[model samples]
Target: MATRQLLLRRAAAAAAAPRGRRGYGSTAEYLHRSIVPTMHYQRSLPRLPIPKLEDTIRRYLNAQKPLLNDDQFRKTEELAHRFEKGIGRQLHEQLVAQDNQNKHTSYITGPWFEMYLKAREPVVLNFNAFMSFHPDPKSEYNDQLIRATNMTVSAIRFMKTFRAGYLEPEVFHLNPKKSDTELFKKLIRFVPSSLSWFGAYMVNAYPLDMSQYFRLFNSTRLPKLNGDELYTDEKAKHLLVLRNGNFYVFDVIDRDGNMLKPSEIQAHLKYILSDNSPVPAFPLGYLSSENRDTWALLRKNLLDNGNEEALQKVDSAIFCLSLDDFPVKNLVHLSHTMLHGDGANRWYDKSFNLIITKDGTAGINFEHSWGDGVAVLRFLNEVFKDSIGEPAVSPLSQPASVDSSRAVQKLDFTLNDALKAGITKAKQNFDTTVETLTVDMIQFQKGGKDLLKQKKVSPDAVAQLAFQMAFLRQYNQTVATYESCSTAAFKHGRTEAIRPASIHTKKCSEAFVKEPSKHSTEELQKMIVECSKYHGCLTKEAAMGQGFDRHLFGLRYLALSKAEDLPATKRASSNRGGDLCQSKAKLLKRAGTPA
Candidate 1:
């Protein structure tokens, strides 16, 4: 009891500090201000432009050249030229026409969503991604219950701020002192919402599209036979908690739409934490890790068994807070735990799962179809700043004197024989799938971002070069590599692929790996500089929506949609022609390589 009192006192002291002074002081102050509305720049952001067909063809050929032999390249080039002058030109025109009709959103948005939702594979490691939080500096604050409570309060605060249009606008500041300052905020706040993007632009700042922000809360990916659907319900005020494979929910918002007091929230989370329920015989969460079609059928069976209310509660809640029972043993273990877990305690369909381990290590595993990392990263930065700076629940805070057992409801499903069998199969499948996967880490302690900045080279480009060198040293060959670059400066933008493998990288890797003594130091250095310059150019092109991948994707999608309308010969020729061309090019390249 004395220990408990001391803890509470410490928490209170931590909570009393001004919210912006704890961590990232200057950033916190810049981001938490409500001067610019969250969606103020949405109307003025540019649309993702459709690259010209000839330009896309040129970029595609360049990207493929590094992986192809001379003969193979010529053949692939011929096919590309044929496509460009014939069916590809028609597809490009149609795609542009379609884009013209859909002026409100980017050309890539619908197709990208479709690409994800139509995939039948399980989402665990395939479609979902995890980003772990750095642990709190205060050892006492890392207590599971205290961390959960504080994170919950901070999340609610973010939601309230965002919905009220006060959440800081997502911006890339070219000149922080000039653009991310009080004077800039004061001037920008008076600009009309529609023109606020231009106003920011004038100050050397670019505001990003926040259209995906709405799905950050109260959203879930509902599986279907053909394709999945994204569902969001902002009115839901409940918080879902998964513990020991059991599902529990309680209201975290009051009738007035305000978040519950920190003490009250802590009380309810503590109640859930203290409940010693045994892991279920057939944990329903495992089903969410199954293939989309399989999960869809099982979900139908569940609904037929009169579990609609239970499923709805799971889906409509404002994000999931997974209370893991085991401590993270190491970095690899923590990554695996947060990425997929045992598949029994994870609701993989949720927009994002806020997973907290028994030792209070926390991270988020988010569903990818509804949004991208940009939106999630912003939420993470804000939540981390808020919780660390102005934690609502500290170790010294006491739980409210309320009967939490009555407030929290444990959701129970009426599972039949088929559902139980399905759950067993899903668990086995998940285990088998994860068993084949591996995660490894390497640290370059000698140099990092600061050193790279001092060297005047792109950090990401150098990192890509390292990967190319490593692969060449291991396999004596270079392979096509992909790096994602966000196109979020445009309205409803998605990601564009930045092809990291280039002829320059290939030459540089060869110089370093084939025979170090043969090349002069200056020659190797020049090769590295060339690779970095080309990589930087690729990165810029992709960010500005001039990359070839999306353009080719759009063209192919249009081709498939209009397949039946085309002449039989054209349709047959267009069907996987590009893929066949690339495959044969790779085969020929391999044949030409020395053993």
Candidate 2:
């Protein structure tokens, strides 16, 4: 029935947008009301004033321009657009500070732990909430207050440390222990609402040591940023092209400013990268899991020296297994260096990271969940240009979109809901189709049969198709049909809407069975493109110009359909569903849908 419906009715495209969605008014009205509700305070964080911050950044850039004298350091305006739109130095705390608050940590809100516990289940990405961070700093609360404050401060501090070009460990390592009794207490009191299955601390946190930091000799001085310096201006022009050079990313943490182990961070990264967003079999809070051994170590390290040392020790320059340091990075050190943990993220508040392996081998994982990849790359190129140390050949320009208030809508639906639905839909769709083809950054342009002939087709499309269809085909032998796993994938590794629809049990049913019939590659491509266009266009149309707010949208639809919510004049309409299903079957037949 689900497959028949997909083949006949274009869910998104065919539906005309209803009236009164956000941003339907004049652009001014949209901007006026659209400013994310959180930024009202940041409209005035006095320290590191905009002009002063800009002046400092400009000066810093001037100093590094000579390093890249060989390469023409052209700060193009177009580059800025890309940065603001998708790439740029992003300050997570600013945003987090606005809305990171929420209900206090307890058993009721345990679902929130999904923020850092993405290791349990594979998640289907949803690009719809382009840059959706969890409840802002104010959305909910627990120990996040102190942690988030420190996170923001640490980010700024990190920039300063970077500009200074060095860090010396201020704290040393310390060991801490937790018992099973604590775990029981957590499970009894604070299991997540969404995933009530896990026990406590499925993964453990180990100790952090101080011997892992670096020291600069009397010779070369590296350029970093200042703790007092703001990465951008009040106007946010720096978001355009990183305001000169050097990419920056800030983590939005708890108010208590608790930091996770490097191994945990790496594990977190990989877990997010994997599609099966599994949840821990254990409870996730501090008291929940037995995995807090590393907490004491982190506390001592940061307590003694500050996050400055913590920044340098992030398994970047040194190989942890060989070097023997704090924050074990076994998770990211792939069996071979061909690591695929590039773009996975757990969107809780504004804690973004840039995991870049220097030279893709230097062990330095560069990540920019805030600025993300594209912006990080531009910053890296700028830094490389700056390393050569040359004056700018061209002037810097304005950023792409200073105000992200409405570039994408803040849908009410959670990533979990999207994951559940997307996987199911994609799988069913795949089973109904003959094949799929995808194009991405990995250009398969080699003409020689020696290389090209060896491969059957591009790996990306193959993976997307296999993952989607296979997941659905394996999930449901009977019902749970939602066969379209639409994921929100960012371009150039940046944030974008991904809503992969698969049959729920999104990835269990054998939804990808090859049809008895076959279609040529050209015909398949047209079908896929049309489907993609339908997805991109209809999403907007349904939300009016303002876009779908998942929470609001879901609530409204559910309310209308709920029997209790029906009007007094309205009695139940029996067999309405059966009629619709019958109509759908007829429509698919008319449309020449394959069995």
Candidate 3:
């Protein structure tokens, strides 16, 4: 009894002791810990400030001056004045109130969301972006086993770094203030969420819902009648491999949810390669590559026929790993694979569709709605850099001889004659579209930003001007040009459109088209200098979120919101066609999409 009581007291004492102190001998030792874990800085991040109304209006008018004729400009300027004093002021006030009341991530969140999420079309290449990696020169594309294993290991390592809160926050322009707005971190989280059944993450409980995360590691997007829906199976512990137009599912994780050994991952790849199967009558997956509404209708037909169970296997898998038989020779060619793979082999909606070619080259086709290029680039950069730095350390034993005990199942569909015809039509449409689109890859062997610096011209502006010149040469005309500028320096901010086609750019483009050698070197250089300066200024304004687009967008929405509150008859009879609302509308319409 005495010994039992002593043991109980010892256990109690240990339980009561503080964990840090128990392990440390000094104050520094006890208190010293990770100062900034991966997401630690998120809470302390400051909110994006609202830009003044007058500043935005003035900037908006300036951007339009280059696009509109004198009479048109006059009408726009008059409207701007009225808008500033009338409904514009009221709307700005409301936006300020709304922003202050809820303190939402950004003042323009409502407008941005409306534009991004409420669009009628599917958010593929038009809204989404893709990127490809430099192929591994060390190996042939046929060495899929080694290449895939490297990619898997690199990705796993990147995730582990993120989980440990060590992933570096993206810094822009070497400004500490800019670093305070770490939207890139949010992008990383967004990717996993989009993949994981559209799950939401609470900030405090981050890395929240491990089951949801595990599902994301094995999730895909399903085609819906409207938009796309994410499907993540908590029970799925593997990736779906697509080769020769056939689908195979296998494990990449153990029962405890840990990623399996690299050798095991490679073995799975080998099995998929060694095995062969007959191609289906039609590549049904190609339907997703068609128009959004078409995919929607087809999906309805699919679900109505009780093929949901079979489709679930495709949708619930983490992502499609396409084993292409073609070689990816360069960045441009690899880019093509990432943007539009063999339409038949790709499940385009997956957030992370990895395409590996027969040459052992690889690229990623990411679904865009989740985040922007910068976010994915950061993740890819880490993986690529890590892969290069770390030597390929293979395990001694080869997974105890390819464990085929995984729940490997082939996704089979019962396609009727109607579905087959639909697929055939989809293929034709896809082919026509592919043929119409021309992607020219240019590699400037010598001149780059350094040359631009020496010539005292902004690289971005020069590029935009080059496009203008090229367009004029091709079509014998000029069109309104746009350049996207990041507003990510603000909290939850996205982007703003900077209209690069100014009077100076137009004059320069016309001069080049009319007679390339007529203008002396000095005269051409002067024109380029002016265009560069103009572009740099506008781009700066956009980054500050004082860009005309978001501000004008806020006011318009605010006016609409107020109109919505009134009776339908009152809203209809309010003379919206008159001067009051016309200016804002006309100005915005002329500028095109502000985003």
Q: Best by lDDT, which number?
A: 1
> What lDDT tens digits, residue by residue, belong to model 1 across residues 1-595?
6543232223222211222212222232232436777888889887889999899879988977888899878977887777777767777888999999999898888778898898899999988999999999888899999999988888887788789787877776666799888789888888997788778777667777889989999999999998999999999999999999999999998889877888998999999989999999999999999999999999999999999999999999999999998899999999899899989888999999999998989999999999888888878877887788878878889999999989999999999999999999999999999998899887669989798778777788889999999999998778888887787777888777888899999888888888878999988877877888898778767777788888887766665566565434242233334454343333222221111
Which has the higher TM-score value, candidate number 1 or candidate number 3? 1
Clashes per candidate (backbone, < 3 Å): 5, 152, 9
User: What local lDDT score does residue 94 receive in model 3, on the 0 to 100 scale?
Assistant: 82
Which consecutive 10 residues in model 2 have the weakest lDDT in total?
A: 236-245
TM-score between candidate 2 and the true structure: 0.26
Tell me the spans in candidate 3 whose CA falls farther than 4 Å from its real position. 1-35, 122-124, 137-142, 164-166, 171-236, 329-333, 391-400, 405-407, 416-421, 515-519, 556-583, 589-595
User: Positional deviation of 125 in candidate 2, in angstroms?
Assistant: 15
Question: What is the RMSD of candidate 2?
Answer: 27.3
lDDT at residue 526 of model 3 (Cα atoms)? 92
Alpha-carbon local distance difference test for all models: 0.82, 0.23, 0.60
lDDT of 2: 0.23
Alpha-carbon RMSD, each predicted model: 9.2, 27.3, 12.5
- Which numbered prediction scores highest in TM-score against the true structure? 1
Candidate with the larger TM-score of 1 and 2: 1
Residue 374 displacement in candidate 2 (angstroms)? 5.9
